[model samples]
Target: MDILYYLQTFDHFIIYLVASLLLFGLGTFLFKWLTPYSERDLIRAGNVAVSLKLLGKMAGLVVVLQSAIRSSINLIDLAIWALIAIVIQVVLHLIIEHVFTRKTNLAKEVEKGNVAVGLFLGGISILVGLIVAATISY
Candidate 1:
């Protein structure tokens, strides 16, 4: 197979969807690492809306990354892949934290136990990656 062809496949699937999952983890760790305030403290401070807001912030960061990647790559097909990746990330995160985990608030779950949160994040990434691979176009 051509190397360019292989790269395209990787960009379409992994760069888009797989990267999104990674960005989620990256963003999560970033905020957790840098913030003086705990997720619970942020919740208690009530200066914000809710946990959904945290997800929103992560989504925004992913979007910014997607935009930067799209600009750098300058390929319509690749940009589409990035869009799919970001959507996969957000959708999967929401699904587990909301649909599967039975937790109304994801922050709470993470606060309860870090290990379980890490597992959930990784599990959702794979689930969403598989779904994106199955559904997205080349």
Candidate 2:
């Protein structure tokens, strides 16, 4: 029973797992930067609406990650597709904010305990995630 052999066998799995986590963090960071208000702050203040919207964003990223993981042939391939997915989600957020939350401030709405806005954004995020996931292919 060689330790090196076991390590080698698990290297790919470990590498991919770490890479996925890093990608997830990057995706979330990008989202945080794009938004006007502080998600952490809002959530800390017990704002269910902010949490709901953030939940959708996270779920959307997971959907994208699932597609990338299933479709990627290698780590580099995964990275490329993951980045593309991130871009798509970011763009989707912008579109949602502009189209759905147009005439009002999304950040303020969420901070003010607007469950309707939160639910709407959450639904939109999941829908976009499904679309992105379905379209990904190896």
Candidate 3:
């Protein structure tokens, strides 16, 4: 293969990689804004529940981003789809939390280190991400 061709391929790879990272950062910021409590503070205080929940959200976002990158016709398309996926994940998570914790408070439980609730929330996030990713084709 020509060296110039390989260099061009690498440049494209770098551009996509950078774009994906920026999209992931935006998604993370959005998720934090939508949540009721401070995940960063809770995790800093050794709250496993918040940690798990955050991890799930990150993983879910990655799944959606991957799909967006694969299906997009251009960088702009990928960014748009990624943003839509982030909004969907965050909104659906809020709805699920409200529905499941009608008699309790998800934020409080998570603050108290309720691992089960965290795991459940995380699982729901991943599930939602998978569904959204699957629907992103063409």
Candidate 4:
């Protein structure tokens, strides 16, 4: 009958976990698909694409962190903020082609599926879970 009740339920946790994973996974995919370099080019240029993508995947840590904060902070507002961040990232990419020094990212080579990135994202999910659990008692 209360939010605490919801938090104790496995279904609630599963739903949150699954949804978070899917969104982060899908976002990573989209970023990869839109990246601008080929494997051949990276090979010829000393693997700059992978390096750059690694940075992005790492920096993307912030996105997942924010999402975790949003999960229990205010779901609706968090969604709106995420949309804004996406727009900003896209715009920044579009406007900075000349300043770019790396080859480009294809999304797949993000450190070979970026196990670290995946783990950190899941960690964020845990943070969300803890926050929800903590808030439930209040």
TM-score for each of the candidates: 0.41, 0.89, 0.93, 0.44
Quote the positional error of residue 83 for candidate 2 in Å. 0.3
- Any runs in candidate 1 off by more than 4 Å, and if so which? 1-74, 101-104
Model 1: per-residue lDDT, tens digit, 1-138? 589988767756654566556655765665455333475575575534334445554544455455535444544555556555555555555555567556355455555444455455545555554554444433
Clashes of 4: 0
Error of 2 at 7 (Å): 6.9
lDDT: which candidate is best? 3
For model 3, residues 26-138, the per-residue Cα lDDT tens digits are 98999888787889988999999999988998889999999999999888998899889888978887888889989999878887999998988888888988988998967
Which candidate order results from sorting by TM-score in descending order? 3, 2, 4, 1
Question: Candidate 4's error at 70, in angstroms?
Answer: 3.8
Shift in Å, residue 17, candidate 3:
1.0
Prediction 1 TM-score vs. true: 0.41
lDDT of 1: 0.52
Residue 101, candidate 3: C-alpha displacement in angstroms: 1.6
**RMSD to truth, every model:** 10.0, 2.6, 1.4, 9.7
Candidate 4 global lDDT: 0.46
lDDT of 2 at 91: 96
**Two-way TM-score contest, 1 vs 3, winner:** 3
lDDT per residue, candidate 4, 5-118, as tens digits? Answer: 877886855765565565555555555565554534654556544544434543553454354445445544444444444444544443443243246532444334554533
